[model samples]
Target chain A: MTANTPPKALAFDVFGTVVDWRTSIAALVGQVLSAVGRPDIDAFAFTDDWRMRYLIGMRDFGQTGRGFVKLDILHREMLDALLVDMQLDLAEADRHTLVMGWHRLEPWPDSVEGLNRLKRRFPLVTCSNGHIALLVNMARHAGLPWDAILGAEVAQAYKPAPAAYQRTAQALDIAPGELCLVAAHHGDLFAARAAGLQTAFIHRPLEYGGAPAPDLQFQQPWDYEAGSLTELAERMGC
Target chain B: MTANTPPKALAFDVFGTVVDWRTSIAALVGQVLSAVGRPDIDAFAFTDDWRMRYLIGMRDFGQTGRGFVKLDILHREMLDALLVDMQLDLAEADRHTLVMGWHRLEPWPDSVEGLNRLKRRFPLVTCSNGHIALLVNMARHAGLPWDAILGAEVAQAYKPAPAAYQRTAQALDIAPGELCLVAAHHGDLFAARAAGLQTAFIHRPLEYGGAPAPDLQFQQPWDYEAGSLTELAERMGC
Candidate 1:
């Protein structure tokens, strides 16, 4: 598909694509660490470690068909294990607050404005691994103006699993070909394309903080590509 | 609960509560009838009959735990059966246009404004039997800004079924008591209350055209009652 004829709907990958989760999580952790007199800890490294654990958990879930667990539960469990590994002591309330940092992440500079522009033309939804409540709270906090929330919890399966993409298209009553999966991650785009969805790649060069960026170039042919969501919206004439 | 202590979230029954389905369906059927040269048919009565069949279908589905079907498919099936009973002869494309009348229903005069006000105070969503796609399309068409769409499609069960209400609250990660099910129908409110949800009743006296309205009076003591959506929002200080 060309820019002139965009897909009927756009489903976004939320955590790193729409919201700058790494920066937000590091900031939140820094504040919490300072409050607990543990500011010596590297908050950015902690955030990256937490995210790596989440990916491992999702991979394990995908490997084993163990019944679906909501992302919040998984995050809390990961936080508990991480704190134990780091020999950190924190109150239950503080731990809960830190785990909920996912809900308060800040959006990318152009995410809200570009989403609003794209929404006027195509129905916009989140097809992330986040649970519905997490997605709803994030959208409310970031003013992301999504038409519907569809993701792992709604599909009872996480990303890279065919069920997640298939269920989202089914829920929208649209064929997979009519939907576009927009993400900053090549893996997500590749999986969505394999599921028969059109794919758009938005470059997020700083998604990993000081760490080396993933391949921002389109590894293979995709439906669309842009430097940012705002450009994507402009390309689609939104 | 008092007006000072509102529920964490408000879940609305969409069909007759938020949208004036009776008037909208009658208007659509009237247009279809004229197009088919069958203007003599009583559009209002036809709509009533169609709705009655929908109720019976829901009841049957609830009795037998047959796997979930999207509301659109059920509506189309019912339309086919109704057309046959009415001895209507219309092309398949025209029949489809008439069946899609559900998708184009107009909202009640106060729905958009009242929901906007209430949304400021609480996360508002729909808990009707309508599928996710149906609710999303209707909200976009009528300008009803829903934070999330949760209903039969997500729960895989129709309303009055315990799972539907339970799943919606669970999806929002709120206790049933922290969720208010607002509806114009007493039966819906009763079922929601039975499932441990707070209930709010908004009067929609003209929900049924010439047919007598369902008991407009609250069948039992509900958490809240109002003459209209605007009144409900005001009572809640939204």
Candidate 2:
């Protein structure tokens, strides 16, 4: 597929591509730590650690198809385990609030406008690993205009699984070739490409804070590549 | 549930309730008949007959639970059977266009504005028998502002099945009691209520044209009842 001929729909990876989960999580963790009288705790490290645990969880799910659980549940479970490891005492309400923070993650600066622009031409949907509730809440909170929510919850399978990409395209009633999976991660794009869907890579240099960034350079050929979602929209003639 | 306490999300019945499917289908069929040199065909009767076949298809699926097929496929099958019965000849492209008419159904006059208003307060989603793609396309065509698309495809079960309502509520991460199912059809509302969801009835007297309308009077107690979706929104204080 050529960049000149855009796909009918663009399915986005929400966590790092559309929403700045690292910064949002760190900010939320900072507030929680301060509220719990532990302002000295490194919120960024805590956020990174939590995210690492989530990655491990996804990896385990990919390796072992032991049924499916919503990402919100997994997030809460990981949060509880992290609290135990950190030896922090939090009230049930506070724990619930912190665990629900995933639902309140802020979108990247370019996300709302870029998506709105893209939406004028093509249907925009989230093809993330997040649960449907999480995607709905986050879109509502962040003012992201998604035509539909199609993701791990809708597919009953996590990302990197061919079913995820295939099911999303099926839900849209489009051939996999007519759907583009937009993400900042190469692994996601690679998997989407392998699933016979077009891929777009948007550079998110600050996705991991100061940690070594994923290779921003296009490791594999994709249908479209842009420095940011705004650039992506511009390239797509939105 | 009381009228004063609104649900977090409103799951709407799209076909006859939110969209004027009968009129839209008749109009499309009229165009197709004219194009095919069969303008003498009664488009309204054809529409009704096609709808009856669709209901029969749903009934068969409900009784069999053999698996699930998207409504688009079912509509195509029913259309083909009807064409055979009528001895009408149409080009493959015309047949495809006629089948695709389901995606172009017009919303009721109050649908767009009322949904937009309700959307400001509660997430508005479609819990229709239509597939996700059908709902998405219809929303886009008619400018219905749906937050997400959840339906028989998502649940892998047709409406009136407990699993449909239950799965929609589960997908929203809300208890069935906290998800309101708004429809003009009593059976759908009753099924939703049986599944523990709140119910709202909007009177759509013209849904079936000159054919006698379904008993408009609320046979059983419901959480909310209104003359139109606009009135429903007003009653809900949206």
Candidate 3:
């Protein structure tokens, strides 16, 4: 008898795995900073700094155990603080418009094509730390046709927590074994695997600024590792 | 000086309002009953019996106040219980497939076109008691392009609770005034208004079966009322 392993759903890690967040944010920050007469400012650094506060804001809520703040709000909070610290003065309306840059992120080259192919074979969705609104807006802007959008904001527990992954399967009414986590980050796949989900590692070597690094190599322990989502879909026999 | 109204995000009620749940479930029930040689079975009674348990399941979860459960899971529980009471026997695989019918409900005739028009100018999303995954799957199945999906599952509280609408706005990072609850049910809009949201009542008369008595007739102090989403979209200038 063939022990067929069927994944009821495939959940993706969005930031670097699906969309090039580093490059996308850098472009947006560069445009905004240049417009505001700060041409020499390090846009990449500015983006990274803004994102660093993301975890901190979530941790504040996690510690208080009172409220769950969506990532878009947390991003805005961080952006406001960072702008003040960087000694920049911008109008309220302009700042609000700039904050929406996250909604306009460009998907990677293979994202749309690969996702469409995979969608024919499995239920494809996002399981990311980004809030539902952010993911939805990003999908709309990028023209990504996702079956569903799942996020930590819905679970109120960020990744690396089993609750996040387990809750996704529970919400979909699929068993953990019937779900696969597709991510570029080893840590994310490790967390998903620990939660009983199958893992598919996608290599996004340039995720941390297109610099050469050791961790980008395909990890063998993963059930599947591919150079890109195109290869991943092909390997999945989509 | 311009007297500016607050930005409004349209929060829709799913289930019977957007989709003809009665017809969908009745068809499926009839099909299953006929296939099982129980041709004379009362499908309407079965559908209602299955639906009544929905609120009971939510109330039970609320009563326990422990971990949360999604609507799909709750529906499965109810379906299994009802199937037994109806003296029906279904295979495990068939039972799973039948439970997934919620994910495949068709939209009302005006749903897609109306939502598309409205979405051109407004942030449109679901504010249903169903879980995020349930709503998302339904959207994909029905070709309903929602800008975002919000639900009582997000707040761990069901409709009629103020927290449901309040949490939806918080998740979107929009003020309560910016979220207008668009629903057929008076009680849902009443709860939304109580929680400080704008209210638009759409007439979905056949939600509970037969010709629905016009519940919110004669304007009723709402921001707007329309016969269908097409009319609603025109009123919103979309």
lDDT of 3 by residue, B1-238 (tens): 1122734678899877788887888888788878778879898888878877775665455566655567767788889998899788877776676677887898889988999998777777788888776776788779887776677777777876788888888877778888888888776777788898888878887776865433344335677788889988988788
Candidate 3: residue pairs that collide:
none
TM-score of 3: 0.82
Tens-digit lDDT track for model 2 on A1-238? 3554569999999999999998888888899889989999999999988888987788568777576788877888888899899888788887788778999999888888999999988988899999888888998899998999998888989988999999999999899999999998888888898999999998888889856654435267778999888889999999
Residue B196 error for model 2, in Å?
Answer: 1.2
Docking class of 2: medium
In model 1, which runs have C-alpha deviations exceeding 4 angstroms? A1-5, A214-218, B1-5, B215-218
**Each prediction's TM-score versus the true structure:** 0.96, 0.95, 0.82
Candidate with the greatest TM-score versus the true structure: 1
iRMSD of all candidate structures: 0.7, 0.8, 2.3
Model 3 alpha-carbon drift over 4 Å, by segment: A1-4, A48-69, A72-99, A213-218, B1-7, B49-68, B72-99, B213-219
Tens digit of per-residue lDDT, candidate 3, span A1-238: 1133868889999988889887888888888778888889998988877766664554355565655456666677788899899888777775776678877788889989999899878878788988877887788788777776775877678876788898888767788888899998877787798899988888887777766433334245788888899998998899
TM-scores for chain B, listed for all candidates: 0.94, 0.94, 0.88
Q: What are the lDDT scores of the predictions, listed in order? A: 0.87, 0.87, 0.78
Best by DockQ: 1
Q: How far is candidate 3 from the true structure (C-alpha RMSD, Å)?
A: 4.5
